[model samples]
Target chain A: MNLTLKVWRQSGPDDEGRLVRYEIEDVSPDMSFLEMLDVLNERLILAGDDPVAFDHDCREGICGMCSMMIDGVAHGPQKNTTTCQLHMRHYKDGDTIVIEPWRARPFPVVKDLVVDRSAFDRIIQAGGFISVPAGSAPDAHAMPVPKVDADDAFDAATCIGCGACVAACPNGSASLFTAAKITHLGLLPQGQPERGSRARAMVEQMDEEGFGGCTNTGECTAVCPKGIPLDTIARMNADYLRASRKSG
Target chain B: MTATIDRGKATEPVTQIPSRPRRSRRRVSSNSLKAVMAVSGAVLVLFLVLHMAGNLKIFAGAESFNGYAAWLREVGYPLLPHRGLLTLLEAGLVVAIAAHMYSAIVLARRAANARPVKYAAKVKSRADGYATRTMRWGGVIVFFFVIYHLLDMTFGVANPEGHEATPFDRMVAGFDPSRWYITVFYVISVVMVGLHLRHGLWSALQTLGLARRYPVLKASAAGLSALLTLGFLVVPLAITFGVVR
Candidate 1:
């Protein structure tokens, strides 16, 4: 199949970027989106030209390292699929795919389609993991966590720290990402110790990061790669309120 | 001992200075903005319901309608000043309106600021829904309508016979079929308000942490918004069709 690519290109963080189009011939339908990009990069490199820059690691979709805004949608046209996992078969021979990086103020682009996601890291650092002493691992069955709680926690825990929630959100709010982490830890018995502090600290960090507040538009969850539930935000609000009262 | 002897203010960061608790530091977090919206929106909904009920009195004829309008001003006789109770209520409503609009504008500005760059391609998603998209524009229309409504009804400048006319006469003159533009404007603005309230109420409840466990509250919010819309609209239609006249 033959196709065209309209990829965003910028030399550095300060440089103005534009969509540079390239026509490719004899494209295979079975190739992954990233693989097609790799082919384009090889051609550019052979022609002594600058290649398009993007982020990807563990292309099978587990690491959440890949990021792209495909055709105005996060992770392309597929639902619950990562950019790296998206195959080119979904596209037509004459399709002109548009790829962009996450455009939030907090997530500045490091290169073409590669943003500095350290803001997400800082949010997690604020209060994502439980503080457990490093000696012995606890027995899994000893806790006796209810199945419903376990299921919900697992669902929340599936968030891969992809910035798709930020990219997809109309308000560009990180509430979903923040809430997913909050719910994941807040649901477990082991996480009860610092639950109050966790919610307050993380939400404060999120606000400090300059991400817009959620308006419950639900676009974040709808385009979420992990299919993180929107109700995690409700969970976050409940936790934050409880924490504020306790502080008072 | 020598190394430890340099304990002085110069080594400290500016933020490390000890100070009193900062109460004002809690100025409208996202959740707090949402709380403000919910509280203010609740007041506005109350006003709409009461206003609709008052307008419905036109069906009872001039004496009933005019008496109801006049009675609002003379609510507390010797215990309060003239128009005292109504003035107090109006003052509260003004405060609620101010808070609601301010939060909405700030939230919208922040949302815009968060994304400096926009998508190059058109994003088509019906899943985003009609209310989410039209909220800002709908609000603007409603705000303008409120101004026009006050001029026509309360202050009497826009009405045909002026504020001196009986409440019944003003209602009839304002929504007369001959003045189709005013009627059309009223219809458009009220429908926009209905749409705004439908989304706004659900969002307010969700923001206030009430809709998570019970999904039925969302339905109720929609129903109430629709009811208020029809309540307000029926008066204008009735006037235009000569049902109330």
Candidate 2:
């Protein structure tokens, strides 16, 4: 299938960018969206043009590295699917696809279709993990966690640290991501020690990262590749309030 | 020794001042109105449920419905003083309505400003039903309806001659089976209100920090929406069926 691609082109973080149109012909309907982009890049290389730079690794969609806002939606038309997993069959022969980087203040455009998602890393680093001592392992039965609690924790743990929630959010808030991390760790007995501090620190880091607040529009869940529910956000909010009150 | 013993020791009482209650009021933030909307909407859902249950008295007979309305008015008016409990309740409702409106406007404005580019082609969903989509519009319509209801029922302003109605009478007359237009409008508007209340109630709780647990919060939100929608719908249906008259 032939498709018209209007992709954002930027030299660097400091460079002003614009939508540059390129027509790719004889594309296979079975080709992945990224593969089609690769075809475009190969043609660009042959034509003595700069190949469009995008972030991708483990193109199987587990890494969350392949990021693009295809025609405004995070990861294209399909719900809860990553960009790499999206196929050209979703579009028609003459469809014009608008490809751009994730638009969030925290996630700045490093280049075309690639935004810096390090802010998410910093937030996770602040207090997203349990400080388990390095050893062989703990006895699995020692904690004796209820089945319900274990299941809930598992649900919360599915967050892929993708910035899609931030991209999809109107406020550009990382509450969903932050909440997922907080809830996952805070639910277990091992996480009890730093639960309060973790919530406070993580939320502060998120705020410092310049992400916006959660408006409960539920768009994040709608677009989440991992299908991380928005309920984690409520938990995070509760934890944050408790932590702040205790410190205050 | 006697002179030394004569030396007197005097102690003074240290006066500890009571701290004044902190006078600082938390200014409404950008999300504050949303918070207010969420909280008040939840409370209003409770009120609506109770109200519908009370209106179910209409099923017993006209005497029962009219009696209930009369009882409410009497209890709210003459039985109480000029500044009474009912007055305070009415005042609270007004405040809740004002807060709900203010927050809604603020949120709508923010949402509008945030979307820099609107989609050329948007997919509409059944889950994202018409009532859900037109929440803001529904709110405006409901606001107007409330005003009209208050005028026609409470203050008795411009009561049409044929519809010489009390609050209960007005409700019954509005949903008269033959008056299809009125019934249709009532049903549609109430459904809109239900849809608004369904999400609005649970969202209010979430915003107010009550729904902190996962799944439970989400469930409550969904449950509240469903319950409120059902609760609000029953009254109009009952009236239309002549079960409430």
Candidate 3:
């Protein structure tokens, strides 16, 4: 397949970025989207031109490291598939693909297609953890979590911290991502003690990060590569409300 | 494989992640503001339902409609001053509207600030329904329409028959066939209300954490908004078409 690629390029965090077009010929349909980018980068390197820089660690899609907006859709058009997992067969010959970095105030562009997602790490640091003793492992099955709670926690745990929710949200809200972390920890027995403080602290941190409030638009869930449910947001709201009341 | 992966230093104690000190806070959190919006919106919705029901009294003839309007003022007459309950209700509505508008302005501004740079390609989504997209602008239109509606009906300033006229006369004169423009504006504004209410009702449910548990809330939101739109439309449309005097 022959294709036209319009990729965003920026020299630094403060540099003005714009889409730069490149045409490639004889592309394979079997190549993953990133692999095709690798091909493009190889050619640019051979010609002594600067190579495009994008963040990707585990191309298997679980690492949540690969972040790019393909045609204004987070990750790509393929539902529940990250940019690294999206294959070229989804496209055809003579197709034009426009790729750009995540556009959000909280997620600033570090370079070409590489936005700093440290805001997410900061949110996690705010509360996304349990208070476990450091000395030794606890006895097996000591804190037997309910099956239903375990299942729900597992579902919320699938969030890969990709920041796609913020990128795709019309409000650029991080509610879905923040709520996923809150839900994953809040549902278990061990998480019960710090539950109230966790909800309050994490939500406060999220707001301080300059992410917008959730309006229940569901665009974030629609574009989420991990398929994080919107229900987590409701749960987060409920928890926050309860926490606020108790704290007051 | 010349890639260098820095997985934090192995000797660094992973016991506890350093947590930031809590900042001094006075501003209301976004979640709390959302609850305020939801509660206030819900109050306004209930008021609309009662108002629509009251308007339906017109079909019973002018006497019944006027009598119903008079009775509203006389509510709790012996126990309280004339129009006391009505005034209290109006005061509550003003509070609701104020809270709702304040939250909306704050949240909308935050949403704008969240994304400094716009995407080159238009963001398309199957889930971005018409109601969801029109919320901000539709809200503005609804706000203006409410002011106009109060002038025409409650205060009688915009009505053909001014303050001294009965409620029935004001309503009839307001939507008379010759004054088709008023009816047109009324229809357009009511439709906008319906669209706004559709998304808002569901959003309120979601914010209050009820919609997730009760999936029927989504359909109910649509159905209730449509019903309210129809309920409000029938009277003006009936008057304009000469179906009601």
**Residue B37 of candidate 2: its Cα lDDT?**
77
Q: Model 1, DockQ value?
A: 0.33
Query: TM-score of the candidate numbered 2?
Result: 0.75
Q: Model 2 off-target regions past 4 Å?
A: A9-19, A77-80, A89-96, A125-155, A170-173, A200-217, A244-248, B1-36, B59-62, B73-83, B105-132, B161-165, B172-184, B201-245
Q: How far is candidate 3 from the true structure (C-alpha RMSD, Å)?
A: 4.0
Q: Which residues of candidate 3, in runs, are more than 4 Å off?
A: B1-26, B213-215
- RMSD of each candidate relative to the true structure: 7.2, 14.9, 4.0
* Most accurate candidate by TM-score: 3
For candidate 1, what is the lDDT? 0.85
Q: What is each candidate's DockQ, to 2 decimals?
A: 0.33, 0.07, 0.53
* Model 2, span B1-245: residue lDDT tens: 35444434444453322222322553333434455677677666666777777766766777777887666556756668644765676777778788778877866664554343333323223122444466788899988877766665566562332345656676676666776565576666677777776556556666656665645765665676676566656766777786675
In order of appearance, the predictions have TM-scores of 0.90, 0.75, 0.94
Interface RMSD of each: 4.9, 9.1, 2.9
lDDT of 2 by residue, A33-115 (tens): 89999999999999999999999998888898988877778788888799999998888889998888877767777778777
In model 1, which runs have C-alpha deviations exceeding 4 angstroms?
A: A128-134, A139-142, B1-27, B76-80, B213-217
lDDT for each residue of candidate 1 in A117-178, tens digit (9 for 90 to 100)? 87888889999568776689877697788999999999999999889999988888999999
